[model samples]
Target: MTYWNQEIETMDPVRLRGLQSERLVKLVHYVYEKSPFYKKLFDEKGIKPEDIKSIGDIQKLPFTYKKDLRDTYPTGMFCVKNTDLVRIHASSGTTGKPIVVGYTQNDITNWAESLARGFTSVGLGKDDILQISYGYGLFTGGLGAHYGSERIGATTIPISSGNTERQLSLMEDLNVTAVLCTPSYFSYLIEVAEKEGRSLKNNKSLRVGIFGAEPWSESLRHRIEERSGIKAYDVFGTSELSGPLFTECPEQNGMHVWADMFIVEILNPETLEPVKDGETGELVVTTLLKEALPLIRYRVGDLASIENTVCACGRTHPRLMRLTGRSDDMTIVRGINVFPGQVESVLMKIPEVSPHFLMMIERNGELDDMTVQVELNDLASDKVEDYNRLISRISHDLRTVLTLSVDVELVNPGTIPRSEGKAKRVIDKRKF
Candidate 1:
């Protein structure tokens, strides 16, 4: 009951490193032999599989990028034959060609096992009814969480994101104990329940929530916990890495990355070398167990850090610190870098404002101006002076954190469009 796979999850750090080294060596050889794309890349780098003798030698291996997946297109990067693949998922292709990932039966089993371990650590089990609000289909969040919940023997509501009314009604009717979705959607759901005179804080059955699919701040997590009366936990994964692979244990510190399955590296943005455990940098991951499409030192494009310190929950695996922002999602305004998570941290600390916000960037003449549209909670007064004062205070805080003067517009609660999936926090209109 304490752990889904206690032996592995609580494996000694020394042994975990040994296991990782062994796996890494095998993975290098496997990819070189199985994947034509990887073989070509390895040959060009003059790196042999035996060169990766230990995890420390990971630097010698060529770093893979999301762009590599796009260049390979549909099946160019898959290590397994088409007959070996059982399923496939892909990115949205919003930028260019979608990055497609294939899964063999073993890959699917391992993905489910990864999430099952996470679910158990978060206290989900057979008696709990879980509602999965993440979008299904090519998107991995919904299906990924679904199998994990089932693996843990929890009754799952395959209610993909949207239809807030039904989502809430089902939660109450089925006495669901946990809900999985993006933090933004769940926050919006709480707002909707309040508008419909059914505040989730009053919902007795629901006690746990697993939120991810987009970056969120600790402040927002606290706000959701306070508003909905649920233990809000962060889940981490990407479509490329078998979605929803890690979740924070009950300790609520950081999401544990299973070392037996994958290797995580946070690299200095400039040096491309590994940073100290707690230092913020770009996240690079290597799939040690994946067979359908194994990635070696894949650049995940997210800005985050790792913690080698064992968790209070007694899981020996390393923890991935909360994501600060994505390299691609950052907005530069007036030559200042701004991440939506930074803005959320500031806004959530203010009692008068809702956690929901939108950033708009525009170019006027030669200057780029940034505007943050913040939502007001019910506690905010209706007086014009109060509104102006609140706006000025928010603008001041934003300027302090972002180092750029920002225009603040107070919108009514729920005025911002709510997303059923990942929240769109930034709208940049400037033509670059």
Candidate 2:
């Protein structure tokens, strides 16, 4: 029941909405006056800053997307002058120009504060030691978690990703109590630890793992916790929303979205209308506190739902349910929508298979075909008939989940590439 900012975290619902409304008003005005992007967008939509006096008017404001940021590369959307910015972070730009995000002093503070709240919710405090296993530099996961860990007065390790030996070594020697990294990397760490004749399950110091930066499943969470002997909590946020913002409280249910900092909306992807609470939809967020690069009604592209009822831990903020996957990460095969997370969930439940998997999609003639490459754990039988039966079982289970039959390929252990960061789950060979 411990909280970083108990007052803000446990604020009354009506008062929380009022606070959000107040911030939304100021944010609208600030962006309208300072950012050319917002000004032009508002003008083009025939919407004025005054029109958005409350959070309910958020629907009137036009939606923003990652494409908007990409279309206006390198600070075209920035609200402040270069001198006001203290730091900059950008994506890999794998598809186009990297999204350049600037941070003012206040922006950095708020970013750390957001994550600090999350870290504390997971039982991390001043007395804990935190090992940051995320990659440093352009990626936000590293430095973002670093400042947050320090903000909580936790002894912080800036040992960026890669070098499995060193990560495990420092983790053990330093008695690291918490770890921040992509869930896939942690799974690899667990595998490597097992191969090295060491068990993370035996580590007395490590108790909590906060994993995100990619979509995972509740099944994976259960598997990870069972194997590593630590409470695995899902952390939620994107590079666009200031990175590693919210995490599941020790209740281990859903991530609590700070109401005063941001206004979150879960909308139906097709209709662009708010979904009923507890129903899955696209996550749209408006950052009320971002100074250098505030986004309004920005389509975060992740598919999830919100639980507005106060959590068992007594926090009043909305909880972001498990994300199925990003909108872009989804693929349509035979007119059925498929997400990597759905595939992961199905694979993780199979006791004979490892958590590592890759989904391959191809087109033959007029039809689309999907083949899932699953890695076999040591428990799987080596007999050809047993392997065939295992594949049949997996295919049946996948069909039950995805509603589509898929060719299942069971590969030997270590056959799939291990990721030190986000795990690649899809290989679509179909054009258009």
Candidate 3:
């Protein structure tokens, strides 16, 4: 019932690299001529478009960062004609200006097909009614998942996001077979279902879940599966690239990247050179067959490692390790590096605490201090002793794991801000 060629998905590694190189050369030449941003970059480096002959030559191209896209603003990096663009999406520029990404009619089709391939890779097909909870408009999650459902001949209820009551209503009434959203949102949904005395296990239609847009640990995945009555798969991508660039198969080893569309590499962030297999580094992607916004060696700040081998499920497309975190999102406290995912892993272990939380970093007397503000479950709010104990436990955990102490504040329900899209977990009050 799926549209993708199984043979292509499991193509031999040798042939896959050859196909990628051939496509990359064409993509580079096309973008160099059509995109002003790429043209300027190549010219500045004294590199000719024809100089890019193979996938290996991709390293010779200057890397495009998020800042470059921001500088280009709305439509400066668009490679195709304006009339060819059928859709547009933008990342929530909470930190600065939003980076815009445009999709041509073909680009849209390619994205939908690729997403459909991802869905099928994780065992979704025509029988499922997918409930898409990812927000629509400016964000790419909704439309990207919607198209995949339609392509697979499944009924897609484009419910978008929020309106939790309505979302649950549809899940129950419509017998929704699958759900898609960020891991955090899914966690929050489980809590809501439990509070209302609804049993997720009793819901027969619920089966598989595709979650991403935020880094999540295996503990979180197990938590979601235990509470939501579904097999959780990590869906990885960004607004810059069409969403669903990589996805985990049923085996859940690592997400398989579409080598035909994307040439992926793990690079040393400091050296900007390729890292050895099994080594963590920044993820760099070069779009192979893109017509619009063809990015060559674009440095997506996410940290991960390359996995090339036959999976237990028999897929041959190179696998990408679950995104560890982002280079830009790392926090240094007392000379110790900390990631929010690490903090979340610790917080989830506490039974009384709610999933909604925030990390506040500020400078105090020329030294940095972090305060983890977390909301507790409603039933445990009145127990002051329990609250103090929870805070003490968290502080001790942080001190042991991160080698740094932090103030842990237990807040009331609804005190922490809810995110409709990507959650804002960190607030750095220090003026830099």
Candidate 4:
């Protein structure tokens, strides 16, 4: 299957904006007519489809949050008939409710095509044997990755998450040339293999690894590549946005957005105004072409920026900088916004700290409490004086950047539990 529309992906910014405006106008009308939730919202707000003449007019539309989905419950927000929906996927109910997304047969096919593009962008093809380690059922990650590999004509080994021994045994027996899994589990798999006296670096068959479902630094990417003897690439998307919205090419500078399907925008989370090119802001997405559950101007909560400059890979589709952090993940402590990813970055830069760390935010008495629970690589080498000194430096760094003070405690490595899926890095112990 060739590209759906080549010119649109390579369209210049000026023309691209025009295409987005036209599509956005049509989508607004479609949603208003078909979706009850949106119809009531538009009528109550005295808004008309004609009011949205351009993409800039999206600000006039009310922001649709995860809470809106839950308030509508199972089927109230559905734009199409139940018979039209080919699949349903839901996230874990972590913060009170799990967001549910529905897809038509066309929607599922489009999703596979998008993911297939991601695999092809990283040189995955029939010659590659893919071992998928993501969890299947309910959750979208596993099926999305699996179907994408199938669409790309790769030999797939459906090795679901966990079960490290079986995963390794298949890798050796099948001589798996590539693996698709979360970055955290991939790291843990390598760690377990070493303890079992297995060799991953010496495996000549492995060629590439596609890691995602969490935020990871370039440092972590290098570590994965070194340990697994393969090139590591990043993939980005959410269940609401349809997986494989963007993916890294061979160059690995940034991920390329599939512009033909998604009209990606970076807007200031507070102001709701578009950020200039190259400026970081919360990612706002508008589905240019979707039949079922087409979310218009959906706030993804992911913070990132877009670059229009052409890539060395010769795909003129815009590039997105690696995700910095999520808007939901940002904590307001004493009127200052702090991100756990920032704390993780700082901790990772320090050689003594282990990769596993947690940021705890709670109420101590009346005041808000912020503390970084760091796992030290060597327990024997850890000292109270050293902990104090290092935490002081970290406190200074936070005060300099975020204008907030925090406490840091050094704990032994392996004290914190590892996450096979999405890592829980932040713990808000504050009670309402």
How many clashing pairs per prediction, in order?
0, 0, 0, 0
Each model's C-alpha lDDT? 0.91, 0.91, 0.83, 0.78
lDDT of 4 by residue, 1-432 (tens): 234344554567677777778888898999999998899989999999889998889788877776777887776777899889988888655456787888888888888877777678777888889998888877778888888889888998877788888988899889898887878788777766766778688777888888887888776676667667889988887877765456788889788787767777889878888899899988888787777778777888789998978877766778888887777777887667887667766765666665677888989887898888877654336567877887777678656666778887778766877777777888888887
Tens digits of per-residue lDDT, candidate 1, 1-432, equal 479999999999999999999999999999999989999999999998888889889999898998888788878999888899998888755445678888999988999999989989888899999999999899899999998989899999999999989998999999999999999999989988988899899999999999998999999999999999999999999989998899999989999999999999999999998899899999999998999989999999899999999888899999998999889998888778889999999999999998788998889999998889999989999999999999999989988998889999999976888788888899999997
Q: How do all the candidates rank in terms of lDDT, highest first?
A: 2, 1, 3, 4
Angstrom error at residue 155, model 3: 0.5
Check candidate 4 and list the clashing pairs: none
Sum up the clashes in candidate 2. 0
Better of 2 and 4 by TM-score: 2
Q: What is the lDDT of residue 161 in candidate 3?
A: 88
Segments in model 1 whose C-alpha atoms lie over 4 Å from true places: 94-96
State the TM-score for model 4.
0.88
What does candidate 2's lDDT look like per residue over 278-394, in tens digits?
Answer: 999999999999999999999987889999999999899999988888888899999999998998898888888888999999999999999999999888989999999998889
Candidate 4 whole-model C-alpha lDDT, 0 to 1: 0.78
**Could you tell which candidate, 2 or 3, scores higher by TM-score?**
2
After superposition of all CA atoms, the RMSD between model 1 and the true structure is 1.1
Show model 3 residue runs off by greater than 4 Å. 1-3, 378-388
| C-alpha TM-score for every candidate | 0.98, 0.98, 0.94, 0.88
